[model samples]
Target: FYKHMLGRKVIPADLEAFDPEYFSNLKWMLDHDITNIVELYFSAESDELGQQKVVDLKPNGRALPVTNDNKHEYIQLMSEHKMTNSVRQQIDAFLKGLHEIVPPELLSLFDDKELE
Candidate 1:
């Protein structure tokens, strides 16, 4: 469907079968904060070479998303433990910008405190 929608040739079914090697790299990417699926998709579509170019660019994964109920508490814990400056900045930005698109009460669930 994706290839059809985009007017690109569909990858063959034999190739589409999940390769063990691909999964290993995919797992590494997931574990090490490498680019998520959405970012990968955007990068792939943005280029004429699609996935080939996206693979070359190698966008890193975003910082983890905050799931807890208390934003202030999460921030305090991260600050107390001396998290990286980049993580700290991401957290602060989320706190400031979260309420803009989200209901204030629901903001905590979707916000990535460490996302820049």
Candidate 2:
């Protein structure tokens, strides 16, 4: 479900989806300062030629640098931001259309993955 926290695939069980180099890159990022993730902001290519349009994930929190202790929270927020917050309008629109085609109450009976 959308309300459920997304899985952090950094664990060993999820390693089947990754190559060795992927883990190496992740380890590299973990060892470095969180400044390396400054590009984590939500962005899309703009209609104006080659420009990018950056959309803030939240009103707060982006200003602070992520530390080792708070990295788990950062990852959770990032997942939430990427999966839902950033595309909220689109998701709403999609849900509205889906509900129009199929009843939302019935749809809600199944989890998102099962619905998919």
Candidate 3:
């Protein structure tokens, strides 16, 4: 999915590269579906700087619709597991910033509760 969505082959070196495309794909995953898999991938790649890169690379405009049919299950699973303080803080800050620009009708799509 990463390769297909990103329009590039992800080589082993890509993981360490932390290139713009790599972070862009991660943002794609997060915006398309809020899933544990996305969270795990983000967490594994996350550093203070990396998190900022992901946020900066995220798409602007209306939110993408959730396509995963099992999205509710994923949300439940995420809520069941406790997030580290750092991750929580990152998410909180991201959502707060997002809410400021996202359209009012689209705000529900990014409800922080569903992401938590």
Candidate 4:
């Protein structure tokens, strides 16, 4: 961070990275009811735990299967979890440290993409 602080580009925002094709397939499944929706659920690993443990997106989320009607909500929840909730603490910590060097007010100068 100290090194980057002096660079031309100080703090570049991290973009939400995802595979387009995966979503394309999801959209296709949503369109075609005939297409069998694969069994899936919103889940993640418990990073805090040393042993492998599953983290459900929400209460009873794991027990619930992804069906046609609920698939839309599933996708949305998945995206939200991955983009925001998953790394929320990490993002906050990073920004807190970053602000010590580069003020948050200065970040307004660069757009989200520009930060990258």
Candidate 5:
């Protein structure tokens, strides 16, 4: 009696009827959702830890200029810790000028507040 939805084409009988490019789109959306969820979970976990996750890639470096390589590194770190845009930009600039100047203790400057 109620196969009529499909019979009347209210809904497609095949998965592709819902979305022609189903699998690819579904996978992309799922991956994005998972990433967002993971970021949220990590953020909550970090709040519990009372510390932001830090990655010390370079050792004993002064004012570093934000280079393309450093930008890439910054992006990697940002994604890992879900860093903020302002913080990412600050770090990026620091890296870009690092060779010419010394960077202040970033963690100290951030004071437990880093952009995501």
Candidate 6:
């Protein structure tokens, strides 16, 4: 997921090789109080790979969606977390985003009533 946000493809072997570098770089940024590190990285990448290919990364405050097929897993997570209203709202927003992206037939497995 971090790789995806970084606009890189997810290859396990590549990630294994890259993780140490990423950590060290992130540590340096943090130590230096570099709040715009992501922007800087994206700027450099955009210079190399064209602006269209490098998306501006921002935190949208949304959790990754739980699709219809993952409803049970979401339920288990809710149960474990005691299902607060804030969490429910986060889950609902995520599911709503998934509804926009996922095929309708597949998304139908998500019980709308349950979301309410």
Top-lDDT structure, candidate number = 4
Candidate 2 lDDT, tens digit per residue, 38-95?
4443222222335555544445544555566565555545545544554566767776
**lDDT by residue (tens digit), candidate 4, 1-116:** 22232233221121123445655665665676623647677675555535766778778777877777777767666655555565567766777788898886687676655675
Tens-digit lDDT string for candidate 6 (1-116): 22222222333233224355644453444345333333332111123233333322223212334343433343333322322221345556665676578754664454533333
Candidate 3 residue pairs in clash (backbone atoms < 3 Å): none
Ten residues in sequence with the least summed lDDT for candidate 2: 4-13
TM-score, model 5 to reference: 0.19
State the displacement of the C-alpha of residue 28, model 5, in Å, after optimal TM-score superposition: 21
Name model 1 segments beyond 4 Å from true.
1-86, 108-116
lDDT-superior candidate, 1 or 3: 3
User: lDDT score of model 1?
Assistant: 0.32
Deviation from native of the Cα of residue 96 in model 5, angstroms: 40
Give the range where candidate 1 is weakest over 10 consecutive residues by summed lDDT: 38-47
In candidate 2, position 38 carries an lDDT of: 40
The model with the greatest TM-score is 4
* Predicted structure 6, TM vs. truth: 0.23
Predicted structure 4, TM vs. truth: 0.59
Kindly list the per-residue Cα lDDT of model 5 for residues 32-77, writing each as its tens digit: 4333232211111223245654333334222333343344443333
How well does candidate 6 score on lDDT at residue 103?
A: 52
Q: What is the C-alpha lDDT of each candidate?
A: 0.32, 0.48, 0.37, 0.59, 0.33, 0.36
Count clashing residue pairs per candidate. Answer: 4, 0, 0, 0, 22, 0
Instruction: Put down candidate 3 lDDT per residue, 1-116, tens digits, no spaces.
Output: 12212223334233323345654553454457554443231112235745533221123311332335644333333222223222556555665666578643554444333433
User: Model 1 clash pairs?
Assistant: 33-61, 34-61, 35-61, 91-113
lDDT of 2 at 111: 60
**lDDT by residue for model 1 over 3-93, one digit each (tens)?**
2212223222312232445434434443453323323321111223233232111233123333323223333332222222223455556
Residue 37 lDDT (model 6): 34
